[model samples]
Target: MSATGPAGRVQPARPGDPSHIGPYRIAGRLGAGGMGTVHAGVASDGMRVAVKVIHPEQAQEAEFRARFRREVELSSRVTGPHLVPLLAADPDAPTPWLATAYVPGPTLNQHVLAHGPLTEGNLYAFAAATAQALAAVHAAGVVHRDVKPQNVLLTPAGPRMLDFGIAHAADGTSVTRTGVMTGTPGWISPEQYRRGTAGPAGDLFAWGALVAYAATGRLPFGSGAPDVVAFRVMSGEADLDGVPAALRRTLEKALAQEPGDRPSAAEAAQECVTLLASQATQVVGADAVPATAVDMVTALWDVPAGEDPAWHLPPDRSPSRKRLIGAVVLAAGVIGGLAGGVAALLPGSTGGGTHTSSSTASVPPSSSTGSARPLASTAKDDKDGTAANRQASNGGSATAESWALTRTAQGAGEHDVARAVLHDEGVVAQELGDGVGFSPKSVRFQESRREVYLSYTLASDEEGAMYAETEIARNMCLTVRDVVLRLHPDLPYRTYVMVKEESGRDPQVTWQDDFVANSRCRSAADDDSAQDSGTDQDSGADQGWQPDEDGLGQAMIPSTDGAEIRVADGAARKIIAGTNGIRRTLGTDRVLGNAEIKVGFDPGNSVMYVWSDYLEWNQEQVESWADLAAGEACRALVRERESAGSAWPYSRYAVAEIGGSGYLMIRSGTATTRAACPA
Candidate 1:
């Protein structure tokens, strides 16, 4: 069975065509579109498959080719029964084609068209399955940017989601066009059309609209041209005429225009499944529950216990169960601090009781007894305070400093605190927002060897805004900054103080700069000596020094001639003089240390440095250098705070690296304030 091309054109059946894709063989053609053509292929074993081939015209576009590659990559990373499994793909071929596990059934659109509106049972099943699929896709950090009835396959097994060609990663990706809209007009969310940012919630909105279509056999936003449908979506109007009352609330919430207001896919699935069970009870009358009903009841009851709190079950029974178990185990292992309830549900467990010999106690048997640890425990912890502070006045070279800021009744003192901190550190600081109405405050600071940013929110009078208010604000701010510094111990940057002012006006902000300047800073100040070696590669040294590897620190040294450098308790070593290749090793003996890479020429002239955590390189030094260089472009760095079941030491970091210097630095702060830079 060969693949089909655009407009339902059939490609010649070749020797490689095994008459199947996953479980289905080529039976005939179903349809075609501008993107690809679908062929009715069958699985060699016994199931049916749908194979899609890129249109000749689309295949010619480099952008389309990149998107196609991403589709394959994302599909390969996710596993769920409700999601059409990518059985095969050959993106490198002149005519790229992808084959998915055959789902022997009509699309939701076709089914609704042929059989009128779906029954309550079918609709509930559809909702649960779709939500589960969306949850799985989102967990993998990818959003199904295109979700609609035409892309949903209704099979005896359940509703299987197909086509993720336009999926986008939540962390952001470079492949997508900046402002392109992708997906069916009637079913798309407003966010998708407006900012072109489709996250997990956007998919939920589409799911709600899709459910409405299944129930009433009409578009949720009413029948209209693409433009009109888009207008309705943007306006937050959804027609839910025939939707069941049990699902009305859930649908309404899911269809909310604001992304944060929508229920997560897992929550939606649970709601749907619960409703279906309740409906089944009503239909069966007062008679004894049937075996099928009993099984479903068992599954429903065991869902929370057997699955991860984050686990979402697809409509398909087998795969959903597998995912549930996997999620349960993974969640349990990482959240040990909170796994007491879950530990009791393991197999062959004994009841909780005291043991006389001081041995570890075992848990009782139950569905939830796997483990109860958080996922973040797996990462290594890096201490944020100085070694001297950590060791309490030891004779070691390490010294630690701590700064505090407090806001008074006045507006948020974030900017003031930021400026003070940066000034004390001898680094530049910039205030974000025109310093208006409860906006968060930010400051950039630089020492002779490092630069960092500290961001904190002020308390607002409103009850809802108090979380960002008061003494807790300073604590929270410091905690976030400390976590980031700990993760990248090698980086020179450190955020020491975060304060909330109680005064109505901006509070006083203060900081301390380095008492001793390094050789790098001294060399950067000399021009005549630096310019004498005009040929020196480091001759372009800028006053703005680039951060070193690990995004924790900065390095400033003469870029003129290579020189021998010595470190505390370390042998002197000769490094290249003129080139930009200066390597700094991190976390060698103590928690942190400073190193220098001598550039041959004087460092007075301004130089541009680039730093990025994502830079690709094979050599260790080069990779770290690249990270330092790329960090310059970032405005701030944020690390995930520990939660009930997770301890993230370094979930994410926002950094700002000087664009041209190949210098990189990481600071603790919010991503919202980071200035957009070219990819």
Candidate 2:
């Protein structure tokens, strides 16, 4: 991490800028915000960091200084694996500053503008990564309060959420004055706009909007003057013209007007991961670079003396989530920065729903298949095909081209067909319109029997939504019929609308069988299906060899006489048993899954792969057990080895599959390499 960083490449530090802050030698500048300038600085150790220094004028104010110190204290609390971990800080210094881990990449806004929207694979990875980051943030009990595209940074591993100056726990004190509206204008939630307190729910709304921008190159609510955009957001009038089909349902709930209607960050992440599995959104090539991190910027939305509050570096498209704190400056990320563009290649779009958020129905289990194509966009399906035709004739801007409907072959299996419909929000929203607005709750697309079904609570389920429920169902039926007939005109287009018992999970889960299960899908796309979403981790990913007919795989074996057998499991096991070479241990037996990686633990901890059957437990039962014991396993490993060596802190984490055995292994670190346990 150098004093002068990549961000400094854009603009050099001004003549008046300080040459050093603490041990960091100032090089150039990242950017300036209302609070202070963020410069690229290098420590004597040659570590590069983004240094935020407060302005002298503000530093003189005790109240402002207090806020800055508070922000630094709170910011230090957020130390997620991918977060911009705080490197150094000196709030009491004559010129106060804070340094953060510097990531090398463009912001999401810049990446999109330069690359013209992400591919379906990149988008899923992007969503998954952001969701993971948010999960960590929310788990820490801190509300980011602001999350938008500009704040997202695109890197090789995935997206990381940046900035925490203003982030605070819901149970903690509020950073901004009460009644002050703080946040980006267009991306803020209705509750926040009305000055209501928001939690993770509000951030979810911004996440949906950010995804929309990534896919359509436009905000869900078309960009407009502040008042207009705010009105549209409050009114649930989203402009989801070109978003892809698969993602609409999830995004709809995420963007629901009610803060309570959005899925938890973890749930949203699972949806993205699963949807990607269905869509086969895997890395496309050797050169493929996965995106990482969110953007940050600063802006002020004013309220009168009796009134409100307000809130990048990326682009107006600028860096999205502005840093919450900086020296005399109460906040960081003063704008006017570099960043990009509009390209549509996504799953869905919507205005919102009145439904309350609910947990997903039990996911049967993990699964995969690639025979899928994105469900066609519904913007073209509006009004009995008239608009679709017009748009196509006019070059498909509002229809197919922007959405980029992947061509489908005949008889794409029931599995593939179910995926297209269940995943695509544009198709669902357009087909099921105003009277029948329905946000997706849970959808299961079974390949067998060509069945695609998921439960749904009405979009609102409030008085307005209930009153229109009947009509919504009627319209939903009509649209489903038309959509079915259009896609599988020759095959049996069977769609049944049923009402099922309420699960009582949400008050809004009003109707039984509130879902419409339809199958017009005839076949999976050919070329896409051929690409493997993942190879067996044992053979391909981990660079391990598959066992031969007799179970002799690639390994190295040496006997006492110095005799050796090449590619022998004996040799491999012996080699792994030693500490100097392979970092992790190889399972001695083939009973468990050949490849098992541990997750959620610090490195340098020992672990052993165990079979569920050996313990008389089923895979499901053991999986749950492993999750609960992952941390303990590392601690135990450290404890058991304490007499032998010093127990350093555990740091390694990964999710590994226990061999073919029913149980999956979840451990922290290798026993031989990761222990510093005391005797």
Candidate 3:
């Protein structure tokens, strides 16, 4: 809040203005805006100050304070002379008030109005200072959503950027209502008006507009009702009537409609500062910082210890750089003597695999242990403890999950975090022989994408152990997926489980299956290759079921683990006909376009898994399309089954649409149902 009267307007204190606020005495009102009212005051220490006190109604809104606090946090980190400095703040007061270092200056709006448009050199210098300030602000991941002439205070030492009550994070969050218009109209960025998150690039767009405004003395998108101006900005129709050629080239790129197309605030400022480098040296004066990003941010921002202002500042790029703090957790590996093969590693059982002679440790629910059950399984285990509970809390209230898991292995020294995640000793704990142990490395959670990436380094690098290590990596994917869903059930994201190969630091993405991506069923039964992977588990070879080979009749019932099918003769033909109907309907040029649809018979169940290249499983609306496509496909199959004297409803064979990052959704229950196994 620059003292309004020194070089600008002399507005009197309002009739209702208070004489005293906190320990300061209000001398006069400086200005009033939508966010708050600024007043020139005298502190108890006899220091002149500019205090901004929020309006009562706006003070009551929690989100306003959240944004204010975010602004304060970012502002405090940035003491650039061109940007306003946050001296002290008491936002929790009945009416929030923040103090800033008093500067006697007129805003660019007032300066331009009184002194006419700026000369080319003056405009370039002002843009340099503002850009330098913005670079510091943005380096702290803060975006000054409002960047116009009025927000700039034209002091003798360049220009100072102010009014940060509407600042937001660089990643963008719902600090404000979605799609609601924000910031001053004529100066707002196209993305800000287009119902999307306005990032740091938005501020740069505004900076471009401000530069244009100074150069031409006109609003870029012509002032009008916010709706009209927003329309113009979103449509890329700004009225740059008189911008000079040299400035126009730089400003045009800054005013690009796409955020990615625009230059960063730092880059734009550097261009102008570089052109006027000789003149800028004299412009810094005694208080203003020089024209570099680092100099602006690190210069006047430091406070004298505990006296520094209060507000949450985001940690530096990495947690390690945040502060000098450290902790050590007991990430010790599992220690158990092996007696049998890996396959018979199940609790209280002995198969061919190397078994651990350790007590079966009871794990709490999947929620407590971050355990999740996959939808599919290789072989049926009586004590597998309910693989997946399809029931939602509100009776299947969920449409379909858009959550996906993204696994990556790029973190340096991330073995500990990964070790802790895979550190659990489940009921079926087994130790593989010789040199095939994995040390849990690291796991990363992507909040925006809602995906988790886990990286594991192979503790052993012996020859001929790649296959065993890869299997361990596969197992980790299942374990990590269950853990992530159990922990973050509400997130609409995915998890990627990856392991470091024995040879190098490259990630061996062990779990890329649709089940892992969508957090759905596992396909262990279909993985006859797992037996050849040297794990001693029940190979599907002994099962009498062969829906694909023997067809889905009573004869295939023996192959099923527990389900009992009571299908009459010729039931397979009818089911095949019904499936064909769905294939033709979905495979048409319009529905899935030229995408190939692969329909495979689920081994034990009469159900099937319909995969299509056209399926965008990650989309929120994919479930409806899946239901429509599967419904039509199953309608024909059901109709044929009924005509063949079988009692099967389309509802019984309904597909539960699940989204995978780049995989086709599975129609779980109905895709494998051979011939109606009634309860």
Candidate 3 lDDT over residue span 176-196, tens digit each: 111122465567677665544
lDDT of each residue in 231-293, candidate 2, tens digit only: 567768776666667777878888998887789988997787665554342433323322322
Best model number under TM-score: 2
Where does candidate 1 stray beyond 4 Å?
Answer: 1-28, 42-47, 60-63, 165-181, 284-679
Better of 1 and 3 by lDDT: 3
lDDT of 2 at 366: 12
Off by over 4 Å in 3: 1-16, 33-36, 165-181, 278-679
lDDT of 3 at 382: 15
> Which whole-number lDDT from 0 to 100 does residue 82 have in model 3?
62
Better of 1 and 2 by lDDT: 2
lDDT, model 2: 0.41
TM-scores, each model vs. reference: 0.39, 0.40, 0.39
lDDT of 1: 0.39
lDDT: which candidate is best? 3
Q: What residue runs in model 2 are displaced by over 4 Å at the alpha carbon?
A: 1-10, 165-181, 279-679
- Candidate 1 lDDT over 1-679, as tens digits, reads 0111121223334222334332234554443322334455543344334455544433444555677777567656766656665555666556566655442454566567667777656666677767777887778777776577766766545666765533331111111111122455566677766666777888899889888888889878764223334555776778898788888889999999999999998898888767767655666543643344223433322111111122111122223212111110111122212111110100000111011111121211111111111111111341232221333223221122322222211112222233223221111111111121222233433343243333333323333222222212222223223223322344444333232223342332211112122222221122323222222123222223332332222112111110111110011011111113332252122221111221111111212222222222334545444344323222211111212113311212223323222433333221222332111
lDDT of 2 at 153: 59
